[model samples]
Target: MTSLQVKDLDSGYGRIQILSGVSLEAKAGAVTCVFGPNGCGKSTLLRAIAGAVDTWSGSVRLGDQDLTGLPSHRVLQHGVTLMPQGGGVFPGLSTKENLLMGVYLLHDRAQRRHAVEQQLENFPRLRERLSTKAGQLSGGEQMMLSIARSLMLNPKFILFDEPSAGLSPKLVSEALQRVSTLAKQGVGVLMVEQNIQQALQVADYIHILANGTNRFSGTPAEIPSQKDFMQLYLGVKDSFNQDKELHHG
Candidate 1:
């Protein structure tokens, strides 16, 4: 099965350590959500998997290939892509132009054209604003463009860093739905998100990271049973109780 696996990973910036012995697996046809409070090294973990940060020790493997230590471009060629937070798009470029940049690795003109067409189909909203500058789009639209750009490559696994950040409640729901659809389409999705309720709704499995290491990992169904876990690691009252109050009140 296609999967992204990280084993005992330790990585950080120069002289400072952020992630320590962190490990998780993102499987094909499943959405894995990483939850953490601020500064818990969630983004750092994704960056380490994307090969944007240095790994002091550990292995990142996709299927049978060892991806550790490879540069970002090399990692992309291996069917892994990272859609960073804050809608990483060239503001001055048109929506179509920004998507075309995603398939730069495709040398053949016909193939590149086909990739863009497929993305346009997947994101019909972008088709209407194909010529609009990315900066001119709304926050939700920009997020769609960022995700559509990544989909242009048709990667086997996607590392999304806070896809719902800064979006309105309506847009957040839509964004999470799109992510869930990607996993159904057989793309392994590893997302770091602070939207706890939304993340639980769509995630097949959840991993809670604290102090740069995994503190809890379980299926969504199991989360409600762990009240102390929710209180201690997540720093919240019982999630189940909260849900119950919201429903009954």
Candidate 2:
């Protein structure tokens, strides 16, 4: 029943204000998606939550924990993992090496071994490529490796910044399906996505942002297709026209 909460958040680069009063909640066992056009501070929101970016105002809470103002490493230690954009696996590192990197915080050798074994069990595909350079793996496999690496900490909540970027259409579907599966496994997921079509498929709850502020928060089906920005950023153009025709009929 734990949840990640952001309330009355405000942050920006230097004097340039990006996010203003943004707020939302992402609960365990569910997928909460944030969709917005470019430069809307979606990535900044994730960075702030991960403590990668400093927050000028507001707080980030995980259940009872106050995570705001902590450093990035500290946030990860608290079970909030940020999977930044770009296939995050180290290109020159072997698959096993990348996984080992994930457990750098662990002091116990046995514990690190156990974590690696558990992730291999969770992502069997990686086990088969243990000796291969991470860069040599296919894009899909690279993504899996990144997820496995993030899971080495056994995070309660994983923040994804555009997980589907640079993926093929088919891989996008598969990747998003994997994201949904993670939620079902009881991990809270906060995704900042640009692919409206794929995002709509997996989002249990959705938040729309415009100019770095929350514009809407509801279930996917509750989205207002008629809204001008909905059609533009949401890629749901003219669906409202059909709904309007039905209403007239």
Candidate 2, which segments miss by more than 4 Å at Cα? 226-249
Residue 246 local lDDT, model 1:
14
Per-prediction TM-score to the true structure, in the order listed: 0.91, 0.91
**Per-residue lDDT of candidate 2, residues 42-160 (tens digit):** 99999999998899999999999999899999999999998989658899999999999999999999999999999999999999999999999999999999888989989999999
Cα distance off (Å), candidate 2, residue 162: 1.0
- Best-fitting candidate, scored by TM-score: 1
Pairs of residues clashing in candidate 1: none
Kindly list the per-residue Cα lDDT of model 1 for residues 1-249, writing each as its tens digit. 788888889998999999988878889989999988899899999998999999899999998999999999899999999999876899999998999989998999999999999998988999999999999999888999999999888999999999999999999999999999999999999999988888888999877777787766667676555464465356354333322211100
By summed lDDT, the worst window of 10 consecutive residues in model 1 runs over 240-249
Question: Whole-model lDDT for model 1 versus the true structure?
Answer: 0.86
By summed lDDT, the worst window of 10 consecutive residues in model 2 runs over 240-249
Q: In candidate 2, list every pair of residues with a backbone clash.
A: none
What do the candidate models score in CA lDDT, each in turn? Answer: 0.86, 0.86
